[model samples]
Every structure is written in structure tokens, then in C-alpha cells.
Target: MTMTDNPPAVADGFVVRRSIDIAAGIDRVWAAVTQPDLIAQWFGDRCRLDSLEVGAGGAFGWDDAGDFPFRIEEFDPPRAIAYRWSNAVAGALDPLQVVDAHSTLFRFTLEERPGGTRLTVVETGFESHERPDAVVEDHRQGWTSELDELVALVEGAA
Candidate 1:
């Protein structure tokens, strides 16, 4: 995976934004972002999408990071998907619980370019969490690596 020069930026205080261009169509990119099997290949060790609808919820588990509860807030196929997820904590939580101030919003947007797709990811609401700086920094590194992996997977397939 070739990492792009696009650096993560702090937006609206604690929000982090990262973007990359992938050599694939919007449908392919969307699947890589929304499908659990495809997401696990890059985003985490394992992922289980309980639901893919706008009001659905899911869980992602990592060997080292434990589990994260996520709820889908928006689902626009081949374009955008927005969800709120809990920060990495020690214990497991209820995926159906309401998103509190501590949770963060992750939004993935795809735009069709001339030859491929431009993917942008924005994660916000870190200021409401404890150790906002550390969380932002951790996710900054994580998104960079994960997005690079996504690019590698999708582009390789192309």
C-alpha cells in the first residue's frame, strides 16, 4: 500500500480528516468501506455488521484494541456512510446503546473522479471524550494506515 501525501488535519477542534484517491469505481470503493469482510481486511482484525441500514448497529473487534460499538447514522450507497462508534476501551459495551457525548462520528464520503474515486474520511466529536488529543492522534495514525490498506486492496483488484 502506497501512502498518500495527504496529511490528517484537525477540523472543528478535535475532528480529524484524511483523504485519498483510489483507482476504483464508486461501487467498489463503497463496498470496501461498508462490507464487513472487506473492512476486516484493512480496518480491523475482524468486523461484524449487524445491519447496514441507516438505523442499524454493529461491532468491530481487534486483537489488541478490544471491541467497539458502532451505529449507522447514515447510509447512502456508493456515496457516503456515516456512523458513530465508541472509543477503544477495555470492556465491551452494548452496541444498541445511544451515542453519548463520548462517542465519535466517522463519515466516509466517495466522489467519482475522472478515472477512479476520491475517498474522504472524517472523524469528529473527539473533544467530548477524555484525552481528546491522544484519541485524535491515535486515530490519525490508524486512519492513515487503514486507508492505505483500503487503497491497496481496491486498486489491486482493479
Candidate 2:
């Protein structure tokens, strides 16, 4: 596994940001992230989406943690993508006062480096969570483990 100079940290109160450099090209990294088959290898146990375009609906399922539904907020090829999901009800989008209040948006940004690619995940909107501190900490640690798996898979393929 490669090393990350900067580990994930919560910033600006509501955002948790993390970045890792993978020993692979942008295309490979993009495929691993954007493709359902490849994402299952790292991000979740199973992934389902209506389509690849923005505003698509999907769910990431894990036997232990259950499935969480999400909406595609952005879809830019080989560069960036983002999803908004709400965990208030677990496995579904909660009917909160404001949709944005209880929903979290996670963005993936990929940049081509000379030897590989740098992938960053920034998840925000935790301030409105029932337990903001706990939720932030959970996801902050979650990203480390999830991306560790992603780096292993992508780098091993490279």
C-alpha cells in the first residue's frame, strides 16, 4: 500500500476531506469508481443505479450495514462525481424538514499526476445530522478504511 501525506480530517465544521494517490492512471481510477462492478470491489458489497447520468438513483448495499439509497448529484467523467444520501431513516431517504439538512454529499475528485492519480473524497452536510460529531467521526474513519481498500484494489491492478 502507498502512503498518504495527509490523512482525512474534518474541516469547516461540516466537511470531512481525504485524498490518496494511487499508482494508476486517471482512466483506471475513474473506472474503478464510476463502474458498479468495480465499485463493488471496494466501496460496497453491491451497487445499483438507474443510470450513470446526473440525478440517477441508486443504492449501496452491505449485508451487515444494510442498503442506503442515494441520488447522483454530479457526473463528470474521469474528473469528478458526487452523490447525496440521507441516513436518517437508514436504507432510505428520510423525509426531513429540508432535504439538504439531513442529507450528506460526498464528492470524488480525480487528478492526473505524473506517475499516477490523486483521488479525493469530500463529504459534507453533516452539521444537520442528529449526532453531527459522531456521524462525522464515523465517516471520517470510514473513508480511511474504504479508500484503503480502493487503493489496494486499484494499485494491485496497476
Q: In order, what lDDT does every prediction score?
A: 0.81, 0.81
lDDT of 2 by residue, 16-110 (tens): 89888888899999998888888889987987777888988877777787677778899999899998876565534543221566689999999
Off by over 4 Å in 2: 1-12, 89-100
lDDT of 1 by residue, 1-158 (tens): 44334454444458788878887889999999899999999888888788789878777778987778788999888889998887746474554463566588899999999878999999988887668889888888888788878888888887
Worst 10 residues of 2 by lDDT: 89-98
Model 1: runs farther than 4 Å from truth? 1-12, 95-99
Best by TM-score: 1
TM-score of each: 0.89, 0.88
Clashes of 1: 0
Each model's Cα RMSD: 2.2, 3.0
True lDDT of residue 77, candidate 1 = 87
